[model samples]
Target: MERHCVFVTIFVLILHLVQAQNQTGFISVDCGLSPPESPYNAPQTGLTYTSDTGLINTGKTGRIAKDFEPFVDKPALTMRYFPDGIRNCYNLNVTRDTNYLIKATFVYGNYDGLNVDPNFDLYLGPNLWTTICLVKTGISIPFINVLELRPLKKNVYATQSGSLKYLFRMYVSNSSRRIRSVKMGQNHGSTQLNSTHEP
Candidate 1:
């Protein structure tokens, strides 16, 4: 075979192998959001959350008609199906030796000019969320990502078998007017499972 053709074939095979190992899924959940006493930036359709019940008739229309009106908005969906499950949904299955970037996405909008604990806490399988500080004076943090959730960061954990399993949960412990959500994502790695070195 020509040198170029041989190289091209080898590259394609490796690409497929890598892609096969990395899979992604989306897990979603639905809860509720409290309307701010004085909503200035609330979407025209008003913002609300759902409880993920199969029944979609959560009076969403009535709220939209009254608050959203012609604007035709309601609330930001906080939860959703991470597909097979929430954990490992965003990124593909994890194996030892390969590095990955797991991102957590959040959406929130609450400003009382004071410190406010989360309206709820998200449970990612056995992984515990440490905490995040939004004490930027007048800055109202309504959203966050993995990078934003920096306080309880975990980058490296070791395992002999080279695999991990996880799930996700965004439960509201206290009723707050603020709304928010969580998501996950994954990236390519330099090595494969059981390999001595990352690719």
Candidate 2:
């Protein structure tokens, strides 16, 4: 009995260690930033936010954030912008057969001082993720976070409406696969299926 208990404890420890490693697979992007710029100061979030200037091959610089006090606190995250485009994308290498919580945050600081608010769309590769409306301060816009049982191969993209400029952030949260699909978009629909992994 004692030997069995020891074996069970060892198995539990190994399972916990595997879970810890899986939880570390995450990516955060500070859109519209160039190299040598500091990362967003949010270590408490356990995610590293990096510049997206050279990371992707689209988007034009429209504004900077040093002038806005709301952005000054998270300079790396807010100090850049991506103007309207068909599809601005970033390709990332993630673990195969894993699930992820993909989140994109937008804040229009009116950096251009134009006082104009705009709307745009977000995408996950060929999939039409959702649309985002940028509003001024004191007003909150509903954001979307997609839970994807990401195929071993996939890409993420962002689209703009060409009406106005804005700044945003992208966060890819990793989690163990539980459900098949969780959809959040204009259609308001969902489907589920069982996933099987072979040894």
Candidate 3:
């Protein structure tokens, strides 16, 4: 009986070690969330996300309109908006020369009830990463919903200088039967090349 108990403890320890290794180099942030509602696991992705309160000093917290709440994931329901300041940035601690995949999600669900899209710029360490023009109508505001970072393998996607910006990703089957595309910044705009696929 004692030997059996020892074996069970060893199995449990191995399981805990595997789980910790899987979550080692990952950071997920849900902007605009406070203490009580901060740390929660996303229902869709099954990933734990923490509040971004300590990472950024600027920006005001706001929730999306009631009508659009059901259309987005839990992380995208609230946002951090920057109305003032020429440049607002989030501070993250990352390894010096490690490659990381950074993803920022933006969902303009009429959070301000203005029914107008926002336009702004995104920068990465003093470099202009991209111009975030939600619509062509010319609006002015900056907001973010979710931000995630994952460490990548050293030999994968090696660049000569600067960093890589994520735009979009697609998966194609071997038979070219179906294609699935996921565009960053727009979480509700995924497209799949199947009749029954829903966005």
Candidate 4:
């Protein structure tokens, strides 16, 4: 009986240790920014983008833009990449021995909310990216909160240590509603995700 208890305790301890190694970090926006003009002008469309009013460059520069502040209740914000979904992107620097827990959130006034894969397509270095374990979204008073598209986790081996440059982005097929705010959690480099700071 004592031996059995000892084995059980050892197993539990190992499990806890492993869990501790995978703590997540948060990614939020500090400023909201917009591109001076439609970034897609290359396609030769007449669509023009205002510095803070439109979605051409939806970053910290946009959120803090004079016109964009009302919808931007929080300094940390998110942008919905529509027409060309998953096209809304941001760069993050990571380290080797750590994995990232990436979560994407969206909001709506009244939306069907479809077409968000919420996966890391581009990795700065060797990635520990994998498995969409969770996907969930719901409504709050002012807007519907769509979050946890996937509780995805990645593993970085010992050899994979140091700075990693990456892009975390997503898209939506239909334009039901666009809530431009999301929070990201990380195991390392939380400061890099600070949106308003600038590159």
Candidate 5:
């Protein structure tokens, strides 16, 4: 019994260590999840996501329509919609001059039952980042599904002035199997690329 207890304790400690390693320098938010339902690990990415509850004071939580839920990942099935304010912002604390990658994802699965698309602007602090214009189908307000921040290496994608906005990312490789991992830098993160080509 003593040996078994020692083994169990070691297992628990290792699990906690792994979880902490995965979350280092990463902040993931599931926009519309309720407080009790948050801090869940996404099955697709194995990333822990918390509710965007205390990040902002405005916006209301909502789930996508049942018909569209099956087509999206768990993070995209729910969203936070902002209908009252001209602009809604989420406050995050970061170290000064540290490079970071911010990612926001939106999936308009007709959450409001209006069947209409939404149009809005996204901003990074006081600067305009981009305008989100969903394809016209019906009519509704702006919504967001997931938001994430990952700290990057100091020299990766550095610019003299002003922040950088993500436009698109593409990976090219000649490997037949899916590109398992692409190392960003010496101690930076890695990305997985999927491909379906005869090679």
Candidate 6:
């Protein structure tokens, strides 16, 4: 009987991903903003920056330091810039056996002044999420990370595996490297960052 209707359609899609994994999945994206607005007096509450509308692949939007006070009040997300290619994505609408609290932020206000400080390679769909080395000490050096997602299916492809971590964070820096302040806890269980180097 067609293998019992393919095992009853994979058990009704894993029982609709366990009833949509207990209803509570908030996704905030402010990657490379430009004409994409939603964050100015939001301080931070289910953050939103849907420029290019849930981008999945497309690039070329750079801006750096223009009265930039570390993104003032989150100036629509660090003034704006998404300079990386070949695998740039932002298609978040997850819920397939869910468990998420994914927060991704990046700011490199050197913007191409060639002060250069880049290292990018973060993905969740094709799974290899984490490799952002932006420690250029001229100012904008905020590369926040706090991802805890355990989705086994239903679209997971965030690929940026090369660019040599932006020339290895603009040829490495060591002024005693110190700027680590990212505290996000409430554990969703399933977070791993075996230190691929970050400061």
Per-residue lDDT of candidate 1, residues 1-199 (tens digit): 6999999999988866754542232122122333332222224322222232332212221111132233322334222211122122112223334433333434332322233443322323221222111111122222222121111114555456333323343443244433343433221312111101111
lDDT of 5 by residue, 69-188 (tens): 787889888898887756567777666666678777877777877764354444554322221221122234667899888888888888865456444535433334353333222111
Residue 28 miss distance in model 5 (angstroms): 0.4
List the candidates' TM-scores in order.
0.24, 0.46, 0.67, 0.25, 0.66, 0.26
Give the per-residue lDDT digits (tens) of candidate 4, residues 92-179: 3344444454443443312224323232222111123322112112121111121121122354422244333334545443455443
* Candidate 5 local Cα displacement, residue 131, angstroms: 16
CA shift of 119, model 1, Å: 19
Lowest lDDT 10-mer window, candidate 4? 140-149
Better of 1 and 5 by TM-score: 5
Candidate 6, pairs of clashing residues = 118-166, 119-165, 119-166, 123-158, 125-156, 125-157
Model 3: weakest 10-residue lDDT segment is 190-199
RMSD to the hidden true structure, all candidates: 17.6, 14.2, 9.4, 17.8, 10.2, 16.1
Candidate 4 residue spans exceeding 4 A from truth: 1-26, 30-80, 85-89, 110-127, 130-199
Over 4 Å off, model 5: 1-21, 127-140, 169-199
- Model 3 pairs in collision: none
Quantify how close model 5 is to the true structure by its C-alpha RMSD in Å.
Answer: 10.2
Please write out the lDDT profile of model 3 over residues 1-199, one tens digit for every residue: 9999999999988866755456567788898988688788787666788998888888789999998888789999988888767667787767767777877787878888886545555544432322122121124678889888888889988888645655453433223334333333422231111111122
Kindly list the per-residue Cα lDDT of model 2 for residues 1-199, writing each as its tens digit.
9999999999988866754444245565666555676364444333355665545554444333445444332433343344544434455555543434454544555556764433334444322222222212222221111111222212322235311122333323232423333333332321111122222
Stretches of candidate 2 off by over 4 Å are 1-23, 38-46, 62-67, 71-80, 127-199
Query: How does candidate 1 fare on TM-score?
Result: 0.24
Residue runs of model 6 more than 4 Å from their true location after superposition: 15-27, 34-102, 105-199
**Candidate 5 residue pairs in clash (backbone atoms < 3 Å):** 116-138, 116-139
Looking at model 2, residue 193 earns an lDDT score of: 14
